[model samples]
Target: VEAPNQTIAIEQSQSDRSKKTFHPVKVDLPGDQITKVTLGRLHFSETTANNMRKKGKPNPDQRYFMLVVGLYAVSQDQFYLLSANVSEKIIVRASNPGQFENDSDVLWQRGHVPETIVYHGRVGINTDAPDEALVVCGNAKVMGRVMHPSDSRAKQNIREVDTNEQLRRITQMRLVEYDYKPEFASVMGIKNTHETGIIAQEVKEFLPQAVREVGDVACNDGEKIENFLMVDKDQIFMENVGAVKQLCKLTNNLEVRIEELEQWNRKLARLKRMSSLKSTVSEESKVSRCSRATSLLPSKKSVPLKSNKVKLCSVKIFRVTIIALIAIMALCALTISTLCLLSVHDRHFEKHPIYRQVVELVTSSSVALSPSTTTAALQGESTISQSTQPVSRIPEVNFCDILPCDKVYCCPIHLQKVKFLNYEKTNAKEKRSRCHCINCNFIMLLSKISEIIKKKTLFLIFLGIDTTISSIQILETQQSIDSRYCSKNLQCRSGNYTYVIPINKYTPMDVEISLEINTTEPLIIFLCKVTFGNYCSPYSSSQNSRKDFLETTQGRQHIWTLPVAKLYDSAYYFRVAVPGFASCSTDPYFAGIFFTDHYFYFYRQCN
Candidate 1:
């Protein structure tokens, strides 16, 4: 049949009652504006005997569907062409020319054409997508479960996201205690309950696919709500799976290492047992051979069996040789095993780089400290009882304990507060008004003076002062004087100090002095001259002049070693001098001299 204007043609097949079908309807429209032709469906059973039904709904049993063949934007030169079937359940049939005969009613026939129903317009749920359906084109959220066909293996063009690196990232994700906002909680009716889960923002850094931003218009109040980040439980579950697998692999590696250690221990035990058994066997064999040789000999002084004696000697030699060999072998095996085990232990520690560094640091410190102390004791210039005893260990002291500053270590010696002197800088030149800039005139009269007198002794002079001294002078005399010990000519003629290396047991009197200098200026250049000697020469005709140590342009703190020659009827002296000293008047600068029990003639102890 031809429609008005000859735009649509419908052809019906004349067939038996058992097999009934209709031909395809061809519609043609010619116009620049009319770019599409939407063919309406016609239900045959609803039609009257002579004409087709119009403006009426079809019966429940009648089958009909309207199909949009093509939609062309003629002005834009664009077309959206689709082919589908219509029934109680909609389906889209694939377009294959000549697959459907002109006489067949493809829509009415069930299971004749493969189809899928596709909506080309916008679809909305709680949210709306202007161009997509089922799930929004932007972001879709399902409050409840979303069921699908159970076909996990249906994925294609897939690349595995499983990796140890991914697992590590997942493990680093922080699980947090959180709750929904009040607005969301009220809508969800979960305000009273506290929730624990990963934060979306935090997880987004590691696994972006697991988190999504979602927003929707409030329906009840028609209020606009802000977008919020939501985490996908499925992605989180996948990450968990990866983490569990990684942990399993790690556990396996640990188990393997443990097994190796256990095996090594078992072997060591076997070796020990074997060695003991061999020793016992050798001893028993020696005893048995001797008894046999004795029984084979005559009880009286008759000629003993020479053969028997020879055999017994051979057996004794063989037994001794075997036992010696076994002992040597056992010792070698033990040494090798011990080295192997130690190597394994070292490797295990090295796997944790930070921990290994800590271990190495502690070990090196212990090694350096103990040897230094022991060497000092051995090199001390005294043969007294105190020298023989172990050097006393003191608790760790911080610089802040003595000064108002951050923690700092002086090192190797206990800093005892002997004396403190404060002063002000009067000029740029030397401060000669006083005998010395910071004179800490304190004598260390050894408590065991009688013992000290019996042998040469070392002493420590701790002096804390505010400014630098131009020169340090030590006066050692036979007799004690109250205030008659200042003279220019009898100054013992000391100069730049160096190690007074003890070449022999009593020649060079070596001493190490450690000093700390702090200046108000950020940088300063100065020469420090430290001298210690005997100014009073009752037994000697000439004064001792030892200028070996020189320190120039030093900032912060420095240590100097001054070695002196042992002289008779002379006492020890110390002095510090600064040529041009410029510093704050109030800030306390520290200077300390320690008489180490050891004469470190070759090395400085403060370093």
Candidate 2:
């Protein structure tokens, strides 16, 4: 609010209108009737009880009183004695003015106060102010809205708050019901009943600016400053605005997701309806074509033997045509179904950002599911210590065209309600066996191991040196020796050998390891020093001389087997040392590990 400027008027002296011999005299009230004062100004003597000149003039020793309008209560010896007439104008000027207590409330011209006016006692407008309060200034304009720049687009350096982050902060805030203590309650006149609101102390933790420190008051010896805190309700509410925005954003996202789901559902229903319609149309068309062809056929009764042959030929042709039409219709239906499923699947996956990662996981699982008979993947306690080469042409069976090859591979892992394919169990006394199918290397799970172990199924651990893997040593546990299968009786070459042949261990107990020998020599293979520990160097010769050794000899041996009690926990390694010598070159061929189970199932691929 800007204050308007005005010129200060100078009043002329009225002593010129008086007689030349006349001196300024003190005006007496009631007895002498003074009709008018020249220049509309009055002065009072120094001795009067109420003197306007004495109050307005700076000097106290003035002989004659200087004049001014006097608007004040006087010594009330007479009730209505003082009266004066002004011809031109009357001006009342003061540094400070007293309150006006009258019948009529004085209204200022042009809605502005000429000078400062102080009022005592409670003054009320639309609102009340404390006693002795001056004029009240409020931010609200006459239109009842706070004043501010109207344009929002003109703002500079604007930054929008992260509504999600603000929502988290709001969740961290605490709301409590509290009551002021005795002294404070008495002062506030809100003593007993509890007030529910956010505490300033608690709110300060998350929203520091919302709770301001007004300043500390000095206490005791003036050394200690006590905290004086206040909560800005407006600031707290402003922070809450962020939470509202966050909720709105969340609601919108949820709405979009729901809409997408609805669209997906609708598309699926439409595809199903189309499939039904196509099938129905194909059946009707086939029936109609068959009927029409039969009507066109010649009657056998009206023809000879040659004509009968021609009729048969015509009937066969018509039947074939109907069949061909049916086939074409079926093919069309299948194509439409495939195209529709793919389109819907792509659209669905596109909306989900994590579909790429899902695809990767699916692809890896599909690679593991490829058919393998020569390589076995161990599940459960057993694992593939040695990696395998990636198999070419992973067989992909799409139960649903909407899913990729990996989806079929990962179906077992993700679907908990489905059981794995059951494998037939073999007798423990069986000499030796190998799974010759893809089902052995792919569809197995850990649950099968426990059932197999309970059945006393002797699992065969076979090792063979092939072109793919140069050396194979079947380990009872994950920690198996890195060595080729060598005979103790007939030795070829001496070197530090280490190999990791995958096995499926169901329990923590040792598994019986037996080998199927293919060589023509009387071979004896022995575990020079069977140890079970990790971090052992594969080339370390320290265990070669150890006395604790297990030797398996076969008089023209076909199966050199180890006891089931010898195998330890998960990871264990053993050494195979050949002490004898065989100078003759013999093809040391050993097959892969073969376990006797009811069904062939693999946990993981060799790779």
Candidate 3:
């Protein structure tokens, strides 16, 4: 309705000039907690706005709405209170308010809730008719920014110039910015804050790419983040295998309990039905005796016998009815117990360690390890050696295809991975949470396939080369002929249809299939590459010479496929280049390492 003094207020302006331009007023907010404050129009509402403010500043990496509604009616004191956060905390006060109305209706009604809010526009109470907010003054701009409560850069200045108003200003800066993310806020930590193109952008605050990069190498600076290269491939794989084994055992136990409950219910139902039928038969027989007693009750001499027979029939009928009812009650009790068991099963799905283990197995499968990297990471080698065992050492008879139940997925990890959550259930919506942690390393493969490849390195490292690690598709490959392959937008003619290049001929395909993917992590794909070469042969286990080499057939080849998507999706790839090496020497290199143009034999471009 009216305009206040035309002077710009000074807030903490940053080095960037755009951030410095706003007229500012602050409420003193102290402490490190999540806060949500709602600003109302000119007059103050003590009840609503004061209640809505929460404590603490949010980390910039996270995604939450810093919702700014359009300006409501400004009070004479030049205040435009805005609603914030889902929780209700609303306040409206002008620095020097022109007393508009002290009536309860004016303040309380406007204070009830926010009026019509236009997206990215001034939020305000709609005038009884088109009012002055329509004038839309060019001098006034509506923008909001959150401040870091404990900004290292701002903290120093505030402490030096510590005054009540200065302290309030600093505290207000912190309070205002508590909800704003670090990326847009002027905090010194330089947190990773990109609004778009962040894979797992919705997944978490940390870019999966950044985390993977940090995980792949060593954190030598004593920082929390380390790269994947620094991680022990074999050790991680073995540890993951152990976690999967534990999960499989847990799953089997839950299944057994379920089966037992089923059996108990079947017996209980049958017993109740049988008892009811017997009761019906006995009651009929009792009624027949009563009919027989009618013929003998004509004289007084027979009165005593007739009375006794009637009494006996009633007693027998009552006893049989009670027994039948007891059986029915027992059956009902069993059914209730079964229902309770199922409820427990559904509720614990997220809390179950087996479920978490299954997530780990899907994320960490068939990874190669690097040796001599982060040797100190495993300080207690004896402890790890005692605890974790390689997949090779833990022999499984699950590959036996003789019977139905005997057919466990040839890979122990796949056999244990959770799928088909078909039980009518309720659980924490953790489908997003199932994404793999960056450091998980576990290998999964069919048993026969596992025997074909010879591991050449005591320590072989599998490096995922993607532009952004978060974009990588790391998922479990199926182990069964009937399993489902859930690829997005793919025309899967059959359930078993998979994308693997057929390598029947030595050099049949020349079209480079470029997987123009953007990721900074390794990819999870089923690859088949064949070559005829004098590849580096493994050194003899019993040979005394360290540099000893053995000659092998230099012109023979074989076809191979890794079961991976049955495991996880971790990288993005668009270009795939295969090595066309016809001849190479045995250097005791890692065998069966799936290197997409990054490692292994390459086709030499002859000059």
Q: When superposed on Cα atoms, how far off is each prediction in RMSD?
A: 29.0, 29.4, 34.0
Q: Which ranking of candidates, highest lDDT first?
A: 1, 2, 3
User: Residue-wise lDDT of candidate 1 within 376-441, one digit each (tens)?
Assistant: 432333222232222122111112222344312222244223221111223355334322211211
Error of 3 at 1 (Å): 99
Better TM-score candidate (1, 2): 1
lDDT of 3 by residue, 156-246 (tens): 4343322333233222221111242442222212234332322222212321222222122112243332332112234333334555566
TM-score per model over all chains: 0.28, 0.26, 0.16
Per candidate, the number of residue pairs that clash is 19, 20, 92
The stretch of ten residues in a row with the least summed lDDT in candidate 1 is: 590-599
lDDT value for model 3? 0.30
TM-score of 2: 0.26
Is 1 or 2 the stronger prediction by lDDT?
Answer: 1
284-311 per-residue lDDT for model 2 (tens digits): 8767765665566665555474565556
In lDDT terms, which candidate is top? 1
TM-score, model 1 to reference = 0.28
Error of 1 at 476 (Å): 96
Quote model 3's TM-score.
Answer: 0.16
